[model samples]
Target chain A: MLTQRLANIVFTILLLIACIWFAVIAQGFEASGLLASSGLPSKFFPQLLLAFTGLCAVIIAGLYLIKGQAGGDSGETVFANFAEARRGLLMMVVAVACYFVWKRFGFVPMAAVMGPLSLLAMGVKAISHYAIVLALTVLVYLVFTQLLNIQLT
Target chain B: MYGDLQALMTALTHLAQPVSLLLLVGGIVLGLVIGILPGLGPPIAIALALPFTFYLDTVPSLILLLGIYSAAIYGGSISAIAVGIPGTGAAIATVQDGHKMFKAGQGGEALGFSLTGSIIGGLFSVICLALISPLLAQLAAKFGPREYLAISVFGLVVVVRVAGKSLSKGLLMGGLGIFLTTWGLDELNGTERYTFGSYHLYEGLPLVPFLVGLFAMSEVMIGAERVLNKIEFSDSSLKVKLPGLRQLSRMKSVLLRSSIIGTIIGIIPGEGAAVGAFFAYSEAKRKSADPDKFGTGIPEGIVAPETANNATVGGALVPTLTLGVPGSPAAAVLLGALLIQGLAPGPRLFAERPDLMYSIFIGLFLINILMMFIGLIAIRFAAKLIMVPTSIILPTVMLLSFVGIYSVSNSFFNVGVLLGAGILGYVVRKLGYSIAPLSIGFVLGPILENALRQSMTIADGSIVEFFNTPIGLTIYAVLLLTICWDRITALLRRN
Candidate 1:
């Protein structure tokens, strides 16, 4: 019971921190001089949305802290089991890696690593799966580059 | 009327071109392949084709996408009838009777009936589009910002209700989705919102990349979770045994009623093919002499939902092309395509480009006609294609995503966004958040913001004055009635 309550309180604090971050970001921004005279500047809508979202987050956090787990609607988490958590987090890493690789190297290099990297991330096995992935990649390259005439650097 | 006639003439001319003919066939074949594949739907099929459209003429490009849209919905039924797995959400209701028929050794019969029913429903709705779009466009010309606001609100509420388990969760996501659009420069005023300090943020989140990311990229990630699972189903009933005249005559009433139901539901902002289908199925069951025989592979049961669901494609397009409040999520994505082409959907579009509207009507009609022949040949080929390894399909699709999104802006940032959106889509779908609300919310967000801001300005900060318009007030009243229907019925039962 204490552990659950502690979890709720911590989550609420984290949400509150996120709200403060948004509020600070809003404050740090500048609205154009054209709309500066319009009483409600451009920041008005974003600030309003952020504020409301923050308030809701705070309320939800309060509910969790006060009433404990609030009836129903709980299901699988993003990191449910050990295998899933590792895969999800690792996939996020691979995605970032792919993005950077696409940035540094060309699409061809990114394409080469992306399949095997993602496959390895998902724990998919067999050498044939890798061949299938490579063949599929080459087919995509041929169609997009040769047929559709897209310039993929 | 003169403009519509001219547009029809232009469309006929466009269709005469060999490229358009080839594309029409190509799109239908592609749509069939997509529809047979589990976890891919019409939106992904269109998104994959979006980048390619950048290089082509508008007419051929649109015809190709429209072919994909119309045929993809029809294709999902093929899978449902054959393997008991619905290829798309719209075909879920079809699975009950369709798969049952397949299981009972009537696989060819079910496929035939479903394909025939789909064409009938699709053509019927296309006819409705030809007749009714101009009329609805005329009516929508009278709406002001307040009226638009009311309609948008109704859409959002309906979407939230239809989307998922928790109302608050839907609301939160919907709000978050809209709030993201409040970035970039304001349209009404030249002020910057939450653009943070990047030139890329100036345009806010780019529409195509954002959407493709949200729908396609997300789906890919979600597919990763279940990709390893052995999905094994085969149907010997590969050849289509289309219903004859007598069978068609017998199911005529079922076909007509479901078409009407589908068209009406399609007119509503939130409801789409799935809702129309399930409702038609239930109505047929309620009207039937033996309700218990519904899931027992009755032809009426299969026809009612399958036809209605396909009809919904046309029904959903009605408001999308006119009022600009998308009648469905798929229509919302279609709306994004319109915006990309610099075709702003509204009453103005009707007046300025009646020919384009007319062409869409005639083209949708042609697309459905071509779908029948395309479906006949492709369903057999598509079933065999399903045996194509997902390992190959996934990497190829991913590369297509890269090339497609890249070809649009020639930017790697957009591709990253696509991958990001795909991951988001995968996660939320796994979390049971229907991508419909998110997609609709994103499209409707700017419209909602502008309408509300303008209305408030006119109202002088008074909330009461916002409800001043007669059309707007009536729309709000209808929205209230729809939201309260379940609660009112529950209360009556208690009393």
Candidate 2:
């Protein structure tokens, strides 16, 4: 089990690195010609935010490392158990897969695949649940294509 | 006054269309159904319905979303009373006494009190919105860049302070949300920051799709984890029984106080309905002659939280409509709807489209009145909705969100943004960060950037001049006072 204390510390450290990298990238931001005279550079706000975000991430990492928690969920795991984590992570994968399917194969194929695949990802074995999800997928298709006159493809 | 009356008349004419009327009825039913379901709150309800608004007229679209907003808050109470598990965060306070009464076979009466209290509180706040918005808009019209900077800072800082227990975590999320907004072309200058050579990045991330993903898709993924959780309820005694005139009159003071508390809390940016309900609940209990009886099947216990939660609808619209700042997460989604209508929300919105303003005011009032009748009928069907399995809901919501975001602009890039945002939201939420500040920060990002740059230009490197405006200074002072209020009170208590 991944505790929140361990997870947040790792997450914040990664976030701090990303912020620093983005702030460095902000230095190369350039405004063209007349736009250069604009009151502030394009990078100021983003850099400022990156700096602030980095500072907060540093503080949070310190709190978790030293104090063992960040106010809530003292010593609690990120997930209730391995099953919950697997289900959640699998759903995320299903979402990304659906997006790629829709983009490459088209809406109908994506729609046809998403529902049953999602149920499978969640380890659902109930046939009625699959039927209901497919029915909902078709209903969504009709609402968008027939009623709203949208070109789902 | 005469001009305002004529605008009101015109607004009524717009709202009287058959499409508008039908959507009003349809919106309430949908709102009630969605609100009855666990894991779907007002923000998701509004976001799910947002894509449909692309094809309708502005007034009808707004009416549909507003109907959802108002009824969704009221609908949460029905589940709170029927089952111990709250359907929305706002109903968490209601479960104490509401479900206890249900077990005692007084389910009908408990629901009746919540319904009536919700209506009274909703109507009261609508009246307040009508009275207060114009004055607030007028005052907001006098605001300059410095003032907007102050208010944006105030909104983001206050949201971070109040949203979650960890200030640093909230601030980190808020900064990340705003940082993402700076990806597109800079509005002040033409410099490209993070467009990555893509034409779709020219407009920055699309607001509607990003928002829909952040709320709807993230919820779907999170909900998938609890696919097998079962809920049981007996629908036999679910019929609502309205309170007698005597019972209503007896609780008038409680109703009035709760309404005021909810409205004031709602008017403050980021102090959402959940906060309002808890405040009103505690206040009612504190003021009660028999405080210990609050959670033991008491009507006042149900009325206080229900009334305050519903009242937050109107109270939230004040800041969202009059100031371009959203009062709550749901209101932030509503702001996206306003943007989709090609209307920039601010004080100028009132002057430019008085009919629209009048439409919102009158439409909300009508929604409250109509919800009472619709709620009576909707309660019988709410049990079925409550029993819906999370496994079924997760995939269905995910597909709807996918199709809905794609249909909004007919672009796959927007859908990609949707997926990316959903994953980000899911990971952050799993790690124990609230999304309120993130959403609010995204909405307020452009405003904050423009105000900061313009104020800097005006101040010309002088920090003192940047703080020169009286209105801006006053806003900062109030913000400072708000941040220190707890410590200030503690010191005074020691004295």
Mark the regions of model 2 whose C-alpha exceeds 4 Å error after superposition.
none
Predicted candidate 1, C-alpha RMSD: 2.9
- Tens-place lDDT per residue, model 1, B232-290, is 66747778899999999988888999888888888888798888989999998998878
- Span of 10 residues, lowest total lDDT, candidate 1 chain B: B424-433
Off by over 4 Å in 1: A1-20, A28-34, A55-72, A75-92, B1-4, B492-495
Model 1 chain A: ten consecutive residues of lowest lDDT:
A69-78
Q: Which ten residues in a row have the lowest lDDT in candidate 2 chain B?
A: B1-10
Q: What share of the true interface contacts does candidate 1 keep?
A: 0.32
Report, in order, each candidate's fnat.
0.32, 0.90
Native-vs-model 1 lDDT?
A: 0.77
Per-residue lDDT of model 2, residues B1-495, tens digit only: 126777888899999999999999999988888888888999999999999899888999999999999888888888888978788899999999999999899999999999999999999999999999999999999999999999989988888998889998899888988898999888888888888789899889889988899999999889888887778788767989999999999999999999999999999899899999999999999999999999998999999999999999899999899889999999999999999999999999999889999999889999999999999999988888888888998899999999888888899998999998898889899999999999999999999999999999999999999999999999999999999999999999999
